[model samples]
Target chain A: MTIKVAILGFGTVGEGVWETLHTHHEYIQKKLSTPIEITSILVKDSNKKRNLPDSVQVTTDIEEVFQQPVDVVLEAIVGKQPAYQYVTRAIEHGAHVITANKEMFAHYGPHLLELAKEHNVWIGYEATTAGGTPVIRTIDQMLQVNQIKSIQGIVNGTSNYILTQMTKHQNSFEDALLAAQQKGYAEADPSNDVDGYDAFYKAMILSQLAYQDQPNWDEVYLEGIRTISSQDIDKATIQGQKWKHVATIELRHGAPRASIQPMQLNEDHPLYNIDGVENALSIQTDLLGSITLSGPGAGKLPTASAMIEDLLYVFQKERQQEAQYV
Target chain B: MTIKVAILGFGTVGEGVWETLHTHHEYIQKKLSTPIEITSILVKDSNKKRNLPDSVQVTTDIEEVFQQPVDVVLEAIVGKQPAYQYVTRAIEHGAHVITANKEMFAHYGPHLLELAKEHNVWIGYEATTAGGTPVIRTIDQMLQVNQIKSIQGIVNGTSNYILTQMTKHQNSFEDALLAAQQKGYAEADPSNDVDGYDAFYKAMILSQLAYQDQPNWDEVYLEGIRTISSQDIDKATIQGQKWKHVATIELRHGAPRASIQPMQLNEDHPLYNIDGVENALSIQTDLLGSITLSGPGAGKLPTASAMIEDLLYVFQKERQQEAQYV
Candidate 1:
């Protein structure tokens, strides 16, 4: 059996998914008891040169993807517009959906999940938060028995890189951000990361998952590292503290109160040592105390790795359902 | 529907499981789509005082537990003898089994998993290794795509506690051991922890999981923290290093090479800040780079939390199977 997969975008993460699926084809097939074939890839330009196999179809039309009997659709597009539409269409057509689009998922994930449930399909958005960290799965498991009291983490890699550079090298915020952009860690227009919108989106995703309820975005406090100065870094270092752009959410009175800000963390804090493009989440639960997971927050391979894990999960669930009939 | 469970040991973890289940009865039921009833508890001394509800039948005879319509059996026994036998028997009786017996599982887990597979039942031993860390599940997910290159961690809390005290307070190994025992972190024997056998077992379990092959017990190197002196700690501190009793397994040439020994880690190492009784694991994968998980490694509630999560997994799988039939 072959599982037909459609790629909604031909960006870095999409290209990574293609390469990894081909590179580990044998092992993945052995594990899933079925081979995965990239049936179609939707891109903005069909004339763009891509090093892809001849058998795979690369098209500019989204309808070409749905024309085939796609078993899964992976959305790697950045924003909400067509990614949400493509995901809902895939679910309606009886295909499972996996996405790395954080902006799309952070706002419409709950609704998409409900639609998938109604259609007896699955929606996986593990890459929408901290890439390759498995924080979503960890929280899902903990919620089985424990109440998540709080979640605190450094979720934005670009801001973290900027903060680490400013603290360690005594560079100004502008200089650090310039270095980050040159190193491909930040975009040219970095307001989404430096102004805390990126971390805010991730914090909302975590809050929704932990509380099973959407947070009031207006109520969530937001502060960015754009205002941090070189003197502030020196002051924090003198006090044995490190500045980290942290995303935090606490369950208070059965409601999730969340914020994204630059906080001075002591040496003993779980996320204190998480430096430069590394993400760490410290989750406090009633039954298990504190559990911290740290890893690569964002990268081409790491984000694609998360999406592949979700794909593997969808296949495993399908195998289980098939075994039930036998 | 109701799931019937029997626990075979009335120790700390068993008591914790009972208390947590009762404390969060409504929440657990809401998640599982069924209520779990502890129908019986197998204990050596039935007359011993236990603060348990009368509805739970405490029994001295193991046969009495199998006589009931048990769907799941939780084994919290300490050693290999009865745990292995009882687990095998439970599988033969067509019951899913979840165990916290590291010694038993480290040696006989593969055989029991095969037996459970033949009987079409599930086996969960999440508490056998690092308690409440979910390293086992994390490795399972990674195995779907990435090759686990290495696993390094402080899997034993007692040795870590001793090392922390030795480094921070300049205590001798004997004094640190005494302090650990007083703090209820070390057992009376202390051989399993201080002698590195406990960490050795956990390392073997991780090796088996990552490589799907048992490491030869004779080939695996093992060392304890008993030989570390105050002078060594002081010298390492001078060199800006700290001692950690780490369990490590590397997949070299498609085979697992395992070891448990004290290593001087630099400040930049992931496990350097893991002090006191906190446990930490750093997994190096090909696709996701390095991921580290740290949390409470051993305690009554933490260990029981792992078992409860496994129980929830089993129920979720059962629900999926039922849904497939519907």
Candidate 2:
């Protein structure tokens, strides 16, 4: 048997997914006992020059991609608009959906999950939060036995990279952001990252998973790192501290409260040394003490790796179900 | 339906499991949709005073505990002899087994896994490796997509605690070992922990999971922290380094080579800041670069938390299989 997958974008992450599948094709095939084939790729411009095999279908029409039965749909398109629509359609089509769109997942994740449950399909958004960190799976498993007391994370790599540059080089925030942009760590317009929107979205996703409820967007205190000055960094350095943009949510009075802001961390802090583009999540639970997971928060291959892992998980479940019937 | 559990050995970990189950009784019941009942507990002496309720059956003979049908068997016995025999019987009786016996697991895990597979039962040893860190689950998920290159861990909490004392107070190895024993972190005869056997066992477990193969015991170079002096600690500290009893396994030339020794870690290393009784595992993979998980290595609650998580996993899988037929 062969598993069919449809790609919803041919951007960096889409290309990454394709490349990863190609790179680890032999191992993946052996593990799944089924070859995975990209049956269709829905791109904005089908006429764009591409370096893919001619046998694979590249189409501009979503309907065309769904014409054939697709076991899975991988959506890597940015923003909420069509990505949400595409994901809903994928679930309706009885195909498991794996998405890397944080904006779409953060806003419509709960609703989509309900829809997936109704359709008896799975919706995987592991890449939507901290890329390659496996925090989503960790939280899901831990929630089975632990009441998470609190979560503190450096989820936005761009912001962390900027802060790291500022602390290490004594550079101003503007200078640091410019350096990040030059190094391709930050985008041309870095508001989503530096303004804390990216971290806020991830925090919302985590809150929903951890608490099974989320604080209203208005209730969250959102603060960006743009206001941080070099003097602040110097003073923090003198005090054996570093400035980090931390996304935090805690159960207060039996309700989850969340915030995203720049905070000074001492040397003893688990996330204090998580510098550069690295991300870290420190979870405190009632049973287990503070447990922290640190790794690459964002990148092409890392995000792709998360999506691939989700795909593998979907297949593993399928295999398990098949084994049960046999 | 109530899930029947038989606990073998009423030691520290067994007591912890009992306490954890009592503390989270309502929550676990809701999650599993079936209350977990400790139907039997095998102890060295049934006459020994225990704080458990009278409803639970405390037995001195293993056959008495197995007289009734047990859905799960939790083995907290420390040594290889009784634990290996009990685990084999449990699997043969078609019950899922969750064990905290590292020595038994490190030696016989592969064979027991094969036995469980033949019996169509599950065996969970999450607590056998890194307590409360979830490194086993993390590695399992990562292995689906990435080729793990290397693994470095501070797996033995007693050794880490002794080293942390020596580093912080410039205490002699003997003095630190004495302090650890006083704090109940080390045993009266601390050779298992201090001689690197505890870490060596965990390294073997990690190697088996990562490579699906184990290195010969004789091939592994095991060195303990017993030889380190206060002078070595001061010299390393002056050079911005710390001595860590690191358990490491790497894919060298397409085969795993493992070691447990005191290594000098620089400030930038991921495991450098792991102090006191904290445990950490840093894994280098092909696709995801390096990721680290750090938390409490061992304790009553932490180890119990791991066992409970494994129990939940067994129930979750059972639930999934049932859902398939439904």
Please, what is the TM-score per model? 0.98, 0.98
Highest lDDT among the candidates is held by which one?
Answer: 2
Off by over 4 Å in 2: none
Cα lDDT tens digits for candidate 1, B227-295: 888999999999999999988899877789998999999998999999999999999999999999999
Interface RMSD of 2: 0.8
Give lDDT per model, in order.
0.91, 0.93
DockQ of each: 0.83, 0.86
Chain A agreement with the truth for model 1, given as TM-score = 0.98
Residue A162, model 2, lDDT: 96
Q: Give the Å shift of residue A294 in candidate 2.
A: 0.5
TM-score of chain A of each: 0.98, 0.98
| lDDT of candidate 2 over B8-69, digit per residue (tens) | 98899999999999999999998898878999999998788888888888998888888987
